[model samples]
Each structure stands twice: as structure tokens, then as C-alpha cells.
Target: MPAHVPDLTALTLLVAVARTTSLAEAARELDLSVQAASARIRSVERRLGAPVLQRGRQGRRSSRLTARGALLVEWAGPVLDAARDLDAAVTALRPPQPDADPVVLAVAPTVAEHLLPGWLVHLRAGPGGEVALLGGDATLDDPAGDPAGAVRDGAAAVGVVETGTALAGLHATTVATDDLVLVVSPGHPWAGGPGVDAAELAATPQITRRPGGGARGALADALAEAVPGVAPAAPVCELATDAAVRAAVRADAGPAVLPRLAVAADLATGALTEVAVHGLQTRREFRAVWPEGTSLRGTARDLLRIATGGRLR
Candidate 1:
């Protein structure tokens, strides 16, 4: 609250600990030792005259945040978000170098489809920066559960995930998000009109996203809840790529569940349509996943700003 206050560093460290819910995670994120992070928190709390967080159990989980701490988090989050945006804007105007490390972006194929094309074009033409982008097999259940050495082995600088489970060892920042839709071929009656219930959609032919992949089974899982043990039936074809799935639908493939962003172009062109599922559309989250050992770089930050498509929640 003081104008001349130093050590926003400690404040951020405390914030990181609260966000990550573990001292080890906070230390890894802050590039500090667990012991050192613990000491810093202790020192700050002593000075503040109140504990900021309660260590749950033997300290593996943080059980609570004091009222004062809650107020700080609420106040600080938006400020930090804005500050990061300002930093990104400045980075965008700078001329890039030939020798700069290529920004590695791991993304979901659907996001890579619409946003990536335009975003990359903007980056190269505008930033004139060298960069490399990567995508995982969406057919694969979860990238986090992939080869332990994969992030290290691939030397991946960042990973993008589409789920609720928090990926350990990465600084996760959210980007674009969309509702999951039940996709149908142009010829399908439901494709032309209003949304249908989950039960009806389940009974009809369904082209599920690859089983176990990101949010592929979300609708089916929801369906199973209402009618125990009833999984949404699969369509004749099981395509992996977003573009391919749209093409399949155009060719009269079964209705598929896809992120609205993934099928925006198709729907606009009348190539594919969504039949409403009774329940609410699945809320899908798209996040930028970065390795903890590496902090955010100026260029990467700019890329993120542009990639957000001017959308952030």
C-alpha cells in the first residue's frame, strides 16, 4: 500500500504459493528453494501482522487464505494481469533479432487451426521474429501424462492443455475458450436448426472426438451420469484433426462434439452444423503451458498477446 514499498517480489512469491497451493510449486515457479520460500513467507507474514495462508494437513495443501490475503489476491490479480499486458504491448513494437530463441508453442490442434494461421501471419509479418509451433496428438488423452521426459526430451518451452487437472511443473496461462458443441453433417436435420438434448443426440449416430483425448468424452460422461453406464455411441468414423473432422461432417460423417471455435468456419459456410445437446455446452478451457524453469520472455509475451485474439477472461 506504500508508494515506496520494495519487495513486490515477496508479495508475488506469496501469491504464487497461494495459486499453486504448495510451497514446492511456489519455489519452482519463483526459482527459489523451498526453504527460502518458506522463510520469505514467514518474514512477510510477521511484518504484515497476520498469516496470509493456512497450510493444510502436513503442508502439502494450503487450506485457507486469511480475509486480508483474499482482499490482496482480489486486488492484485487484475493489476498483475494489466501489467503483463502492458509489458506485452511494448515487446510487440520492438524489432526482433535473428539469433533470438525460437518461441516454442504447444497447442491443441483446433486452436492451431483458426487462431494460429492468422496469429502466425501477424507475428511473422509484424514481429518478423523466428518461431516454432508444435501440437500434440489430441488423440492422446493427456499430454501431462505423456512420457515423463517428453517436456525435457522435446525441449518444449510451452504446452497447451484442455482440461481441469492442473499440469504440474508449468506456468499455465489461459487464452481462448469456447463451448463444446455436438456437430452434425450438413445433411443431418438437426444440423440445420435448434440444439437437441444429450439423450436424443446419444441415440443418434455420434462421431465422438478420439476417445480419451481432450474433452472428447465430456458429453458422453455427462450422458452416462444421467443414464448410468450409457456412453454416447460412436459414429462410423473417428477423425483426429479438427479440420479433418469438419471435412468428415461435410461428407456426412456422424455428429461430433467439438469446440465452437474449432467449427466456426464450417458453421459460417454452412458446411457443418451443431444439434443442441439437452444439457449445457461443455465449457472448454484453452491455456498456454510453459515450463517452470523458463520464465516468460518479452517476445513470447507479445506472441501470447496477439494469440489471445484480444480475448482474455
Candidate 2:
């Protein structure tokens, strides 16, 4: 090791930059100017032989852990965490304090795409707080996909996991519900359906959502009860994004069953149509999940209380 090894402050800044991905975002979270925060990171990287971040691209600084840099981050994260853990333990020995880790809520594609904006606008406007999010539309914003698990593991303070299939053993509260309606392109005859029937769905080149999947489950449940031997054939397209499914339906690829919340504006503007099913009106509830034994106070609880209308116990 060199005589001038990086100091603890430099190491902490590096870890923060690594966790946040962007220098500007890290600065915002840490309450520093982008330039000053970045300078600290560069100073640390300069002590190492390789670059730890690629700076000044697209007006944003993105990090790249070089081969040696990767080795250093891997070795350093636990060491830094342990030191902090020791400090926290010592602090805990003295007194109890607020435990808000600044929650990151994970939602399904439809919820994130459609429902999140209003909730987020509410979170930002009212909570004397800020929230950093990972994942949008089911793609991992962070390398680890389970943001709710992050709460359980203490990486995040809270998160919301959306699933039609039950998530057992977590403290969960139901939040809202939306319909999973059969969607078709504006040009389809079912677009102005007097009423869609099981036979009509059977004859069409349908785009069925798979069972146990978020938006798909409602449709799958309806079909299971309506047609005794109906097994959904392979979809013309399989997609994880509501935008993709909506686009596919618009391109006349096939009928897609999706949340009404996701396509509400489209349905109102006549960009798409919800086919009226004679015997099916599929729906599902959205549940807010937190780790077992999680406690809330002040801003986190206030935002949750506002979102759920004060029912969270």
C-alpha cells in the first residue's frame, strides 16, 4: 500500500458516488454541489492508478470501476459498512433516534407508469423529504431487483411491491385497485363491441397475459372459469412494459389485457378501446408491503398515511 492511502472521508464519498451512479444525484442526496463532490471523488481516484468515474459526458458524471477499481470497491464496501455499523451501535447504546432510511417504493409497470406520478408529486410536495427510486416498469434501476427486499435488508427504509400472486410473510396493506380489461386497437370490431363474449375472445388472435404475472392474472383467472379447457395459446408478443403492450395492440398485433389505469387517457381520447366482455370484468388490488416489524415516524409515515388515507397500522 502507498504511504498516502485514501482517507476515510474520500472512501465514504467514493461509496456514495458508487451507490448513487451519478455525481449530480449523489451530490443532491449528500447535500453537496456537483463540482465539489466530484472533485473529492477524482482526488481519491487519482490516488489509485485507474479511473473510478467517467466524468463530463452528456453533462452528467457516470462511474466506471476499472479492473483494479472494481477490486477496491468490492473490498471496501463491507469495511465501510462495518465501520458505520459500529458507530451506529455505539450511538444506539446512548439513545434512540429516528430510523428513516429514505424509502424507495417499487411498483409494477402499470403502477409506475400511470399511478406513480400523482403519488410522487404528492411525496415531493408534502413530505419535507426526498425519495430516491430504483426500477421503473419492472426493469432493475439498481442491479438488485427487489427494492422491497432492500427495506427488509436495511438498504432502504421502505418499498412497495406489486403482485397479484400473494407475497406471504411481509407486513402488507392494500392500497388501491384497478381493472384488467381486454384491450384492442381502435380499428378492431371489438373496439365498439356491443358486448365481447368468451366465444369472441376464443376466435380472435388474442394476446393473453400469463398467469401469476401482475396485469395478466386477472384475465387468466377469468378465462380459467369461463372456458373449461381454454388454454391461452402463445401470445403474438410477450412484453414487460405497458407501453409495449399498448403499442402492440395499436399495431393490431392482438388483444392485450392490461390495467385500465395504465390506458385511461388512451381510452378517453379514443387512442384505444376497452372491449366490453359479457361475463368478465377483471380487477386487482394494489397492496403496500413493508418488512415485518418495520416502524414509521414523521415524514415516511406521513407520506404513507396520506397515500393510504390514514389506515396504515
Candidate 3:
């Protein structure tokens, strides 16, 4: 033993894996790669001088915790619970500001990482004036859960999501557009070609986001309509983050459907080439949503105005 406390983050990961019973699922929830998760677990085990988990078969399923691992989870649970309580207590002790509402926005990982920073800068520079921006991740299968649901349930003042259809009980304003493009490394066969047809695209294995994601849904809907009998090829790799998908495509893993915003730099630098797919509609609208019938006021209204470029839909 090193005579020091275990890392809080490592302990949290252990609990996540123990509950999910799958290393990949835990990694996805924690926004980590499987390799990274494995490393963290290994480090924790090394510190304890005991194996905490039994590895599972590759490409099949998640690993299970050892009896000692279960014991670690039991010890960690109360520490985590106390930490949460401390956080809440600290938040409750903060003085309330009369001028600012501290607007919290929930958004998907792609927008949060790539698009929201610019928007935040613009909003702060505009008439909103010293607005406090609190951001939350609402990526698919996120440990914190869905962004749209967060807004709908009033946990957040607004949510920016990628969708073509309106969510029930919410007022959706189309704030921006993201075009999903089929991309490949510059050396891949699809590069500089006339592009693939619907059937050909359907039959090609590609890197992709996990199912149930906004991008995945848009792709599925477009493919189902355009090529009735054909289904998309099995994913060569499925990841929770667009960055991972882009990285895979850049490494020549396979052709991937990725947001233009995500691959813009790569396309500009000629590191990746965009391929057109005939008869496929790849554009998905990014909408700012809030509970319907609730009138926007104060900072919330100002944020909505800023997000939609002075237009509210």
C-alpha cells in the first residue's frame, strides 16, 4: 500500500463499472475510451494490490468486478454520497443574485465542444451584459442524461439539440443547421470519386456514432427512405463522441458520416475529403428548445434572442 487515499476519479469509475457491469458502458458514461478506462482500473488495482475486475472477451461484452472490487464499491458509495451532499450544501449557501438568473443550458457533446463557445462569446459581448452561462452535457446515453429532457423538465432554461422533428410539449426554434457528410481519409478509395449511391453507401462498413444519437437517427431516417430494402453496413467502430468518429475516419478506419462542423478543419486542410451520397438528405437542424407555453423572461429571453440571431421561432 502507498499509504495514501485512492484517487476520487478512479473510485467513481469503479462504481460506474460495478453498476453497469460493462467497461465500455462505464467508459461511455464517463466520456473515456475503453483503453483509458482499462488503464484507470489497472492503476486502482495496482494501488490496492488486488485485482478488482475480471476482463471479458474482447468485442463481445463488458467485464465483471471481483469480490474485492465489489467491496471497493461498497466503501466508495458513502464517500460519493457525502461528496454530493457537500456540493448541494455549498450551492445552497451561495448568495442569490437579483440581476442574473444564472441561466443553465443543456446541449449535446458536439455542440458543447465545438459550437457553444463561439455562441457564448457572442452572447456575452451582446446586450445580454455579464450573463452567467452554465453549461451541461446532454449527449446521448450520458450519465447526466438527455439534454432535451432536461430543458423539458425545467432542469435547464434551454437546450440545443440536433433534430428534424419537434419534441412534444416544447417550443423548438431552429437556431442553426449542421450538414452531415460522408468523409474519408484523403487516401481512401471514396476520396475524389463521384461519390457513392444510396445502395453502395448502405453496403459499406463505416465508423459511426452509437445508435439513438441525433446523428445516427438522422442517418437512419434518410437511409430508410432513400433505399427501402437496404440497411447500413455494420459499424466498423461505434463511439459516443464525434471527435472519436472524426479521428477514426482520419486514420482511414472507414468512411463515416460526420457533422460538417466537426470535420470542417480536416476538410479545409485536405486531411479528409467529403463524399456526396446521392438521394440522401444529410442536413439536420439544430434547435433551441424550451417548455411550451412558458414565456421567456430576463436572461433566458436574452439568451434565446442571441442563440437565434435576434429571431425567435
For residue 97, give model 1's deviation from the true position in Å. 15
TM-score top scorer: 3
Clashing pairs for model 3 are none
Reference-based TM-score of each model: 0.55, 0.56, 0.61
Give residue 245's lDDT in candidate 2 (0 to 100).
Answer: 77
Candidate 3, which segments miss by more than 4 Å at Cα?
1-101, 127-146
Q: How well is each residue in 137-210 modelled by candidate 3, as lDDT tens digits?
A: 23456443476888877777888887767699988888788888899999998889999988888899888887
What is the per-residue lDDT of model 1 for residues 221-244, given as tens digits with 9 covering 90 to 100?
666765565655556666556667
Q: Tell me the deviation in Å of residue 34 in model 2.
A: 28
Model 2, residue 71: distance off in Å is: 58
Pairs that collide in candidate 1 are 195-276, 196-276, 197-278, 198-278
Model 1 bad stretches (over 4 Å): 1-100, 134-154, 191-194, 208-228, 292-294, 309-313
Clash count of each predicted structure: 4, 0, 0
Return the TM-score for candidate 2, rounded to 2 decimals: 0.56
